[model samples]
Target: MQEYTQEQINQAESRGIEISTDVKEQLFEYANLIGEKEKVRALVRNLADAVSQADSEGVEDLLDDARMDIQELPDPTIGKLELRDYGYMEEDMVPLRKEAALDYHRMGSKIYRLGSAGSKGEYASKEMIQAHDGLFGMESQMWERIKDNNLDYAEENLGAFQEPMSVIEQEEALKLYDAGADIYLITNFSSPMYVTERMEIERGPEHYQMSMTELERFRNLEWEMQKYPQIQSLKEANLLLGTRRTFGIYQIRDD
Candidate 1:
């Protein structure tokens, strides 16, 4: 049986997850009993390398292999544990998140720099005009894709989920929309909701900070939210901007 290391135990404790030695032993025994194939084992090693390097493309390819291998296992407990506990799932997303953030900041900077010129029509050069337009277009498209890709990735990997909705949560979502922000519901990320609005809010930082605090509260209530009706009832139906398992983007509709 594969021995569980002290590091592994410490990591679990650090996460505040109780992964007892007995559980680890049971997982190792299960792996030995099932006799993991050499091919699957190799793929897992390659996946680890890919994740460590933050190679998003490599991780994507290996993730499918990992998922398939896990599904084929008699009991997928070990497979799930490896992905979640070892941080493969979270690591796999790092590259994409970094790329998106870089793009957002870079494009926003470009937009601000270009906009500072006297006027687009009068002072701006033709080349400057074209560059600004191009950046603007890319910025708009990126916002859409960021949310779409996040929702799709969560749905594909985690499976679909729809917790019971609450009036407070609904109100919070609407509040964001009213402020011209698009909300992206995230499950396994650092934040529960990712707002797609520009960082430069006219209302100032305090309002933005408050919105973030409300989102954190929204995330904390997820377990409690589950006790509400899981049904997609008409009254609960608002503008479902997009969805993934257990999380989705919503906006208020005009009557």
Candidate 2:
């Protein structure tokens, strides 16, 4: 874990932001988890400065960047392995998988940067789709040409359009289906309704729960956001638009 210098701690304290030892420890752990301990510390300092200056936009931007950094960090153990070794392919096709992964990451990064620049709605969606289609087209052409002798290689190289299946994914899919959830392709992510449904429940106040109608509305809102360019851009940028649900039924339950 990374340790913050006393000077850094003092700087944050001077800004009226209390960085408790526990909080610092948590930040350190999170940074280490993402293999970005130093970057995380720098972000914390930036955040403190932003807060001290009452720069809401700066704070939000810094936080958003930090979130992106964390999200982009591959699991360390997984990061060291080639696609074939990572179980994304059955044959020795590390080069192709690496190239595809790089392209996929580039696409995601480009979309994120655009969103951060305030691109929203239809424009954002179009750009995102264009990027996706461009990559998919290249991969599809390659697959069609070489699929006979390299089926696994071809499939793995397609990236998000098709993910290699695993036991864990199978179980999770089962859980989503059993919970009356629907699946949607959010960019390249296989998002299930139940995940956001649970997020809504947890984010609500104590004993709060959504009714069937309310849940349906919430789900629809998410779907709509994905379809709309501006909303999708804002969502990708992690901006809190006025579309999230905050109210629900109050009930006590013991599980």
Candidate 3:
């Protein structure tokens, strides 16, 4: 960044794009994080080096062995952040009880800096490994904060969730379903006479807790959520049935 003149930075800002000071500092942290990833990579290579020396048939070429060793790194958790994954924003997302939300956001921010667990590079390479390390470091720091707080921070910020599942809790039940008190049941009754009509009770496969009506409402809300461009990953989908069935099982598709 220092290589770019202040004028260039100003021009970049004027063009409606620029990394903020916060971002710049984060990038520096990213660089340090990636460096740690490299160290792990090098250690793995060294292990392979020792093995190659013992076995005559092992890795005929030292350089090739080292390169391949680094390329095929063991799987490690990495974070990936898309532009729209606003797990940290204030006004845009469903409320996630403040405590949990803040914890998640802080962790998310840490993960975001390292290209999210080096997920930025799909194909593993030296540079990719470093990027992965950077992300790992950032996430480590975030989780570390959680432990450091003794959970004092997390407990203080929790608030009622505004997601579809949370909304489902507010629905009304029409039958003596086995679902917990939280799940609400609502039927599109053409008349009061249809109340007794058999509706399959769906409380996730094993847990027969969510009434059919509650499930149906969740499915409807989920379908509406899909219209959002940012909700690409199912992870971001708000209407989840904990260990229950997929959201679709609740709906009766019309031909």
Q: In terms of TM-score, how similar is model 1 to the real structure?
A: 0.18
Taking the tens digit of each residue's C-alpha lDDT, what string does model 1 give over 112-198? 211222222222222333344311111323334444444323543235423332223434554544533334432333333334443
Estimate TM-scores for all models: 0.18, 0.26, 0.18
Candidate models: Cα lDDT each: 0.36, 0.38, 0.32
Return the clash pairs for model 1, or none.
Answer: 160-245, 161-245, 161-246
lDDT of 3 by residue, 52-114 (tens): 355424423533453453333211111112212323322111212223323333222212222
Q: Predictions ranked by TM-score, top down? A: 2, 1, 3
Q: Which residue runs does candidate 1 get wrong by more than 4 Å? A: 4-34, 37-41, 73-255
- Between prediction 1 and prediction 2, the one with superior lDDT is 2
Off by over 4 Å in 2: 5-7, 14-26, 76-255
Provide the global lDDT of candidate 1 against the true structure: 0.36
Cα misplacement distance, residue 56 of candidate 1 (Å): 2.1
Best by lDDT: 2
